[model samples]
Target: MTMLTIDNLVKTYAGEASRRAKSRSGTDRTAVANAAPARVFAVNDVSLEVGDGEMFTLLGPSGCGKTTTLRSVAGLERPDSGRIAVGERILFDGDGSRTTNVPANQRGLGMVFQSYAIWPHMTVFDNVAFPLQVRKRSARPGKREIQERVAKVLETMELGHLADRQATKLSGGQQQRLALARAIVIEPPLMLLDEPLSNLDAKLRESLRYELKRLQRELGITSIYVTHDQIEALALSTTIAVMKEGNVLQTGRPREVYERPNCRFVAEFIGTSNFLRGTVASREGDLVDVDTDAGRIRLESPVRVPVGEEVIAAVRPECFEISRTGWGNRPNEWSGTVTNRAFLGDAVDHIVRVGQGSIRVRGNPAISIEPGTEVHLATDPAKVTLVPVG
Candidate 1:
C-alpha cells in the first residue's frame, strides 16, 4: 500500500515590472523586465507516490523546489493547487472544491533538520523524552518506561554513553544522533529529513550515511528525504526525482536514471556523460549507424532514428575501454590522443581528444597510459544510449 501521494502540487510568489531603454547603432531599443515576481512558482504541478516502508528522495540543486515540496507535504507550506494524501486521509485537496488544511501538529510526521536542533540547556534524556511527554499530556510515561525507551533509542543510535551529557557538550555526530533519536521516539508513521547531514564534517557525513539508512530500514517507516548532494542521494534513495526550476525532470530508480536517461538534462545531471552528435545513416533491427566527423559508428539503441535525422548519443566515462590493440570485432571503436590524465585512487580518468570534441574515459588505476599518447577506445555497441533532445 502507498503511504503518501502528492498530486499536481503548485506554489507561487508575485512581483512588479520595470522598463529600460538603450540606443545602439543610432536605433532605440526598449526592454521590459519584471523586478522579481509576486507569483513565482517554487513547485509546479509535481506528483509522486511513495510506498509503505519505502525510502523516497527529492534530489536536486537549490531553488529546484525539493525542499519546498517536502515542506508542502509536511503541512508547513500550503500549496496553491493540488492534493496530498497520507494513508487514507486526505491532507490537502484543491480539486472538487474540497479544501482541507491539516495543521502540522496533527500530521503524524517526524522531521529531522540539517542543524541539530537539540536544546543546549537540556540533557539528552529530556530532549528525547520531550515528544512523548508532549503527546501523552498528564499521563506521561513512568520513570521506568521513559528510561527504557530512552535507553533503547540511544543504544540504537549508538549514543547511550552520552545520555546524561548536555546536548551542547556532545560532538557534531552525537548531536545529530540525538536529534534523530528525538524524532524517532514518537515513532511517527512518516519521516522527513531535510539535508540532515549537511552541517557535519565530510568524514562524519560519509560514515553517518550508512547508519542513517540502516536505522530507517530497521524502523520500517516511510521516509522522504530532501538533499542537493548527488552522492548522498545516489547512495541512500530507493527512487530519486531530479528537479530543476520548479519541475521534476525525471523520476526513477538510481540505476535506471543513471544508465538509461530519458533526456539530455537527466543524462548530464545524474553523472558524467560524453555526448556524440551525428546524423543517422542507416538502421538495421536494434542497431543504428551514425555518421560523425571521425567515422561511422554502430550503436545498439532501441529508439528508431530516421535516416538523415540528427541525434545525440551519450556514453558514460566508465563504459569505454582504453587499450593499445586495434579494434578487432568491436562494433564501436574510435582512435584519439590522450589529452590529459588524472589518478583518482581506484580509477584513472583520461580526457581523449576525438574529432570535434574531447570525451572523458575512466579505467583501472593499474592500467598505465600517459598524456600525448594515441590510444584506441572500444566500447560495446549495446551499451550506447540514444536519448531524445531536450
Candidate 2:
C-alpha cells in the first residue's frame, strides 16, 4: 500500500535584488530591458511514492535537495509546484486553479531533526506528553490517558527511568530518544527524519541506528529518512532514492542499488567500485564480454549493449577472489603484481596493478598478499556489473 506520494515537486529560490537576472536554466543570459531575477531550482521535478511500513531513505550529497523534498512533505517549505499526499488525504496540491496546502502543525507528522530540540526546562515525561496535552479541547486526551501514553513511549525508547529528569540533563543519545519519544506519542501516519543521527558520535550513532530500526519495526510506522551517509542508508533503508543536483537519479532496494547501479553516478555514489573503462567485445544472453586495458573481462549483467559499444565495467572490492596461483583458464582471470596492501582489522585490502589500471581486492585477513608478489584475481561473472558510459 502506498503511504506517501509526491509528484512533480519543484522548489526554487530567487537571488538577491537587482544583480543581473540569471535564467532558470542557470545560463548567464543577457539581461532584458526589465526582467525578473533568476530562479534556482532546489528540487527540480522530483516524484516518488513511499510504501506503508517501509523505511524509505532519500540519499544524496549536500545541495542535492534531499532535505528540501523532506521539508516540503513536512509542510515546512511551500513548493513552487507539487502534490503531496498520504494515503488519500491531500496535504499539498498545487496543480489546479485552487491550490490546497495544509499547514505543518495540522499535518500530524512525527519528525526528528538533526538537532534533538529538547525543551531544557521540561522533564522527559512532560516533553513526550506535551503533544497530547496541547491538542484541541475536544481532541485532547484525559490526564490519565496522556500519562499512560507518555510512559509507554518512554519505555519503548528505553528512557522510562529518566522520565523525571530534566530533558537537558540526559546524555546526547538519551536526548535523541526523548525527541523520538515525543514524536511517537502522537502515533502519526508518517514520520519524517532528517539526518537525525548526524549530531551524535560515531559509536552512539551506530548503536542508535539498530535501536531505531528495531523500534520502527515494533511500531510498524512508515518513515521517510533523509541522509548523505551512504552506509547508514544501506544499513537502515528498505528502499533508497539516489538524488543528484535537484534530480533523482535512481530508486531501488538497497541491495539492487548497491550491486546493480543504473548509471555511473549511482555506482560511484552508493559505494566504492573499481571502474574498468572498456568496450563491449561480445554478448551472450546475460553474460557480457568487455575488452579493457586490464584484460578481456566477462560479467553477468542485465543491461545489454551492442557489440563495440563503449562501456565501463564495475566490480566491488569484496567480489574479487585473490590468490597466489593463477586459476587455470578461468573466465575472468588476470595476473597482476600487488603494489600496496592494508590491514583493516577484520579484512585485508590489496591494490594489484595490471597493465595500466589497478583493481582493489578485499577479503578475509588470512589472505593478505605481500607487496611486489604476483597475485591472480578472479571474480564471479554474476558479481561483475556493467555501467553505460555517458
Candidate 3:
C-alpha cells in the first residue's frame, strides 16, 4: 500500500532580479533599466510515492529543495500547486480550480526536526505526554491511557529510566531519543525526519542510525527522511530519491543508485568516483572498449554506445586492487607510481599516478605501500561503469 503520494508538487519563491546588466559593447552596467523578478522553484514538478513501512529518503545537496518538499508534505509550507495524500485521505489539494489544505497539527504525521526541540522546563515524562494531553476532549486519551502510552514509547526508546529527569539535563543522544519518543507516542501513520541525527557527534550519530532503523522496523512506521549526507542516505534508506536543482533526477534502492548511477551528477554526488573520458572503440554484446586519455579501457555496460561516441567510465576507489608486482596477463592492469596514501583506520587509500591522470585505490590496510613506489592496479571490467556523455 502507498503510505504517501505527492503529485506534480511545486513550490516557488520570489527572488531578486539581476543586480547588473550587459550593455551592447559587453560592458557591465550598474543596474538594468527594467528586469523581471526572478521566480525560484524551490520544489519543482516532483512526483513521488512512498510505500508502507518503507524508509524513503530525499537525498540532495543544500538548497536543492529537499527540505521544502518535506515541509510541503507536513503542511508547514503551502505548495504553489500539488496534491498530497496519505492512503485514501487527502491532506492537500491545490490546482487552479479547487483547493484544500489541512492544518499541520491535523495532518496526523510525526515529525522530528534537526534540533531536538525539547522543552527545557518540562520533565522527560511531561515532554512526551504533552501531545496526548493537548488533544480535544472528545479525541483525547484518558489520563491513565496517556501514561501507559508515554511510558511504553519511552521504554522502547530506552529513555524510561530518565523519565523524571529534566529535559535539559539529558545528553545529546538521550535528548534526541526523547524527541523521538514524543513524536512516536502519538503513533502516527507517517513519520517525517529532517536530518534528525546531524547535530550529534559522529559516533553517536552512527549508533543512532541503526537505532532508528530498528525502531522503524519494529514499529512498522512508514517514514520520509531528508538529508544532504550521502552516507546517511545510503545507510538508512530503503529507497532513495536523488534531487538536484529542485528536481529529482533518480529514485531507486541504495545499491542500485550507488552501483549503477543513471547520470554524471548522481555518480559524483552519491560518492567519490574517478572518471576517465574516452570515445567508444569497439563493442561486443555488453562489453565495450573505450580509448581514453590515460589508456585503452574495457568495461561491461548494458547501455549501448555507438562506435566513436564519447563516453565516461566511472570507477569507485575500492574497486581497484593494488599490488607491488603486476598481475601477469591481467585484462585491466596498469602500472603507476604512488603519489600519496592515507590510512583510514580499517582501509588504506592510495593515489596512483597513471600516465597524466591520478586514480585513487582503496584496499586492505595491511597492503600499505610507501609513496614514490611503483605499483600495479587492476580492476574487473564489470566494476567500471560507462556513463553517457552529456
Candidate 4:
C-alpha cells in the first residue's frame, strides 16, 4: 500500500542576493529596493510515492534540495504548489486557487531531525513521553498507558535503564536513540529522518545505520530518509531517489540504482565509476560493445543506443577481478601497472594505469600488490554499465 504521496512539489526562495541585500541594509524593504533578486528553486517539480514499510531515501549532495523536499513533506516548509497526502489523508494541497496545509504537529508524522532535539531539562523517560502527554485531552493516553508506551519505546531503544537520567547526561549515540524512540512512540504512519545519524562519529554512524534498519523493519514503519551519504543510502534504503539541483535524477532499488545508473551524474554520484568514453561498435539484445580509448569493452545494458552512437561504459572498482597473472582470452581484461594502492581494512584499492587512462580496482585485502607492479584486471560483461551520453 502507498503510505505517502508527494506530487508536483515546488518550493522557491528569494535568491541569495536578497539575503545579501538584507545583510547590508538591515531591512527587508531596503533589500528589495536594492535589487530584484531571482527566485531560487529549492525544490522543483519533485514527486515521489513511498510504500508502506519501505525506507525511501532522497540521496544527493549539499544544496541539492533533498532537505528542502523532506522539509516540505514535514510541513516545515510550505511548498509553492503540490499535493502531499498520507494514506488518503491530505497533509498539504497547494494548487494556486485552493490550498490545504496542515500544521506540522497536526500531520502526526514522526520526524528525527539532524539535531537530537531532546529537552535538556527532561529525564530520558520524560523526553520520550512528552509527545504523548501533549496530545489533545480526548486523544491523550492515560497516565498508565503513557508510562507503558514510553517504557516499551525506551526498552526497544536500549535506554530503559537510563530512564531516570537527565537527557543532557547521555552519550551522543544514546541521545540519538532517544530521539528515535520519541518519534516512534506515537506509531506514526510515516517517519521522516533527515540525516539523523550525521552528527555521530563515522564508526558510530555505521553501527547505528544497521540499528536503524533493524528498528524500521521491526516496527514496519514507512520512512522517508534524507542523506548525502551514498554508502549509507545504499545500505539502508529500500528505494533511493538521487537528486540534483532541485530535481530527482533517478529512483530505484539500491542494487538497481547502483548497478544501472540512468545518467553520468548518478553513475558518478552513487559511487566511484571508471568511465570509458566510446562509440557503440555493435549491439546484440542487451549486450553492447563500445570502442573506447581504454580498448574494446563489452557490457550488458538495458539502455538501447544505435551502433556508432556515443556512449560511456561505467565500471565500478569492485566489479573488476585483480590478478597478478593475465587471464588469457577474457572478454573484458586489461593489463596495467599498479600506480597506487590503499589498504581499506576489508579490501585493497588499486589504481591501475590501464591503456591511456587509469581505473581503480578494489579486491581482497589479503592479495596486496605493491605499486609499480604489473597486474591484470578482468571483469564480466554483465558487470560493466553502459551510460548514455547526455
Candidate 5:
C-alpha cells in the first residue's frame, strides 16, 4: 500500500528575492540600492509516493526545499498548490473544493527535529508520556496503561535504563534516542525526521544511522527522512529523491540513482564523479563512441545520443584502474599526469589531468604512482555513462 502521496506541491516564500539580491552585491558596495523580488520558490511542483513500511529520503544540498517538502506533508506548512494524501485521508488540496486540512496534531504523524526537541526538565519517561497526556481528557490513557506504554516504547528504543534520568543529563546520542521514543509513543502511522542526526558529531552520527534504520525496520513504521548528507541518504533509505533549487531532479533506489543518474546535476550531487565532455562520434547497440579533446573512446550508455551531439560522460572515482602500463590492448583508456594524490585510509585518491580537465581515480596506495608522474588509467566501457549536457 502507498502510505503517503505528495502531488504537484508548491511553496513560495517572500524572503527569497531579498537573499538573492544580497548575494549578487560586491564586497565594496555596502549600501543596498533596491528592494529584492517578493517571491521565492521553496518547493516547486514536487510529487512523490511512499510505500508502507518503506524508508523514503529527500536528499539534496542546503536550501533545496527538502525540509520544506517534509513540512508541507506534516501540515506545518500549507502548499500554495497541490494535493497530499495519507492512506485514504486527504490532508491538503489547493482547489478549495476539498474542505479537509487536518491540523498537525490531528494528523497522526510523528516528527523528530534536528535539535532533538526533548524537554530538559523532564525525565525520559515523562517526555515519552507527554504526547498521550495531551489528548482530550476522555481519551487519555489511565495511569497503568500510560506506564506500560511508556516502558514499552523506552525498551524498544533501548533507553530503558535512562527512563528515570532527566533528558538533559543524557548524552547526545541518548537524547536523540529519547526524542525518538517520544515521537513513537503515540504510535503514529508515519514518522518524519528532519536532519535528526546533524547535531551530533561525525562518529556518533555514523553509528546512530545504522541503529535508527534497524529500529525503524523492527517497528515497521513508514518514515520520510530529510538530509543534505548523501552518505546518510544512501545508507539508510529504500529510495532517495534528489532535489535542486526547489525541484526534485530524480528519485530511485540508492544503487539505481548512483549507477544510472538521469542528468549531470544528479550524477554530480549524489557522489563524486569524473566528468568528461565530448561529442558523440558514432553509436552501436548499447555503446557510443565519444570524441573528446584528449582522445576518442567508446563507452556503454543506456542513454542515446545522436552523432555529432555534445554530451557529458561520468565515471565514479572507484571505477577506474591505475596501472603503469598503458591501455596496450584495451578499448577505453586515457593517459594523463597525476596532478594530486591524497592518502585516504582505505583508498588513495588521485587527480589525473586529461587534456584540460581532471578526473579523480581511487585506488590502493600500494600502486606506487606519485604526483606529476605520467600514468595510464583504464575503466570498463560498460560502466561509463553518457549524460546529455544542457
Candidate 6:
C-alpha cells in the first residue's frame, strides 16, 4: 500500500535584495520598485511515493532542499504548489479551484527532530505520556490506558528504568531516545525523523542508528527520514532519494545507487570514485567496452552508449586488484609505479601512476606496497561503471 504520495510539491523563497541595489546603474528607483526579486526553488517539482512500512530516506548535502521537502510533508512548511496525501487523507492540495489542507497537529504524525526536544522539568514518564494527556477529552485515552501505553513505549526505547528521572538528568543519547519514545507512544500513522542521530558522538550515533532501525522494524511504522550522511542512509534506508539543488536527482536501493550510478553526480556523491575519461569502443549485450588513457576497460551497464561516444569509466579503489606481478593476457591489466601508500588498519591504499593518470587501489593490509615500487592493477569487467559525461 502507498502510505504517502507527494505530487509536484514546489517551495520557493524570494531572494533578499541588497539595500545598496537601489543605487546600482541598471536598478534606478523605478527599476528597483518594479523588479521581481529572484526566487530560489527550494523544492522543485518533487514527486514521490513511500510504501507502507518502508523507511524511505531523503539524502543530500546541506542546502539541498531535503529538509524543506520533509517539512512540507509534515505541514510545517507550506509549499507554494502541489498535492500531498497520506493514504486517503489529503493533507494538502494547492489546486486553485478547491483547497484542502490538514494542519500539522490534526495530521497525527510522529516526529523526532534533530534536537532532543524533551521537556526539562518533566520526568521521562510524563514526557512520553504528555501527547496522550493533551488530547481532546473524547479522543484521549483513560488514565490507566495512558500509563500502560507510556510504560510499553519507554521499555521499547530502553528507557523504562529511568522513567522517574528528570529529563535533564539523562545523557545526550538517552535524551534523544526519550524524544523518540514520546513520538512512538502516540502510534501515529507516519514518522518523520530529521537527522535524529546527528548530534550524538560517532560511537553512540552508530549504536542508536541500529537501535532506531530495530525499533522501526519491530513497530512496522512507515517513515520518511532525512539525512545528509551517506553511510547512515545506506545502513538504514529501504529506498534513498538523492537530491541536489532543490531537485531529486535519483532514487534507488542502497547497493544499486552505490554500485551503478546513472550519472557522474551520483557516482561521485555516493562514494569515492576514480573517473577515467574514455570513449565507447563497442557494445555487447549488457556489456560496454571503453578505451581510456590508462587502458581498455569493460563495464556491465544497462545504460546504452553508442560506439565512439565519449564517456567516463568509474571504479572504486577497493574494486581494483593490486598485485606486484603482472597477470598476462588479461584485459584491463596495467603496470604502474606506486606513488604513495597509506595503511588504514583493515585495508591498505596505494596510489599508482599510469600513463599520466593516477589510479587508486585499495586492498587487504597484507598487500601494502612502498612508494616507488612497481605494481600491477586489474579489475573485473562487471566492477567498472560507465558514468555519463557532462
The candidate scoring highest on lDDT is: 4
| Model 1 per-residue lDDT tens digits across residues 241-319 | 9999899988999888888888888788787898888889999999998877656777888887799999887889999
TM-score of 1: 0.91
Q: Please report, in order, the local distance difference test score of every candidate based on alpha carbons.
A: 0.85, 0.92, 0.92, 0.93, 0.89, 0.91
Instruction: Score candidate 4 by lDDT.
Output: 0.93
- For model 5, where is the 10-residue window of minimal lDDT? 28-37
Q: Cα deviation of 295 in candidate 2 (Å)?
A: 0.3
Q: Quote the positional error of residue 324 for candidate 6 in Å.
A: 0.6
- Model 1 poorest 10 in a row by lDDT: 16-25
lDDT of 4 by residue, 140-248 (tens): 9999999999999999999999999999999999999999999999999999999999999999999999999999999999999999999999999999999999999
Using all chains and alpha carbons, the TM-scores for the candidates as numbered come to 0.91, 0.95, 0.94, 0.95, 0.92, 0.95
Model 4: how far is 77 from its true place, Å? 0.4
Q: Of the pair 3 and 4, which is ahead by lDDT? A: 4
Q: Which is the winner by lDDT between candidate 5 and candidate 6?
A: 6
Q: Report the lDDT tens digits of candidate 5 across residue range 1-390.
A: 999999899899867545666677575224434444577899999999999999999999999999999999898998898889989998888957654678988888999999998998999899999999988898899989999999999998889988889889999999999999999988888999999999999999999999999998999999999999999999999999999999999999999999888899999888888788899999988889898876776888767668999988888998889876786988878889998999888889998888777889998877657899999988889778777787
Q: What is the lDDT, from 0 to 100, of the residue 207 in candidate 5?
A: 97
Indicate whether candidate 4 or candidate 5 has the larger lDDT. 4
Which sections of candidate 5 miss by over 4 Å?
15-37
Q: Estimate, for each residue in 284-324, the C-alpha lDDT of model 6 and write its tens digit.
A: 99888898888788888888889999999999999999889
Where is the poorest 10-residue window by lDDT in model 2? 18-27
Which pairs clash (backbone N, Cα, C closer than 3 Å) in model 4?
Answer: none
Report the alpha-carbon TM-score of model 6 versus the true structure.
Answer: 0.95
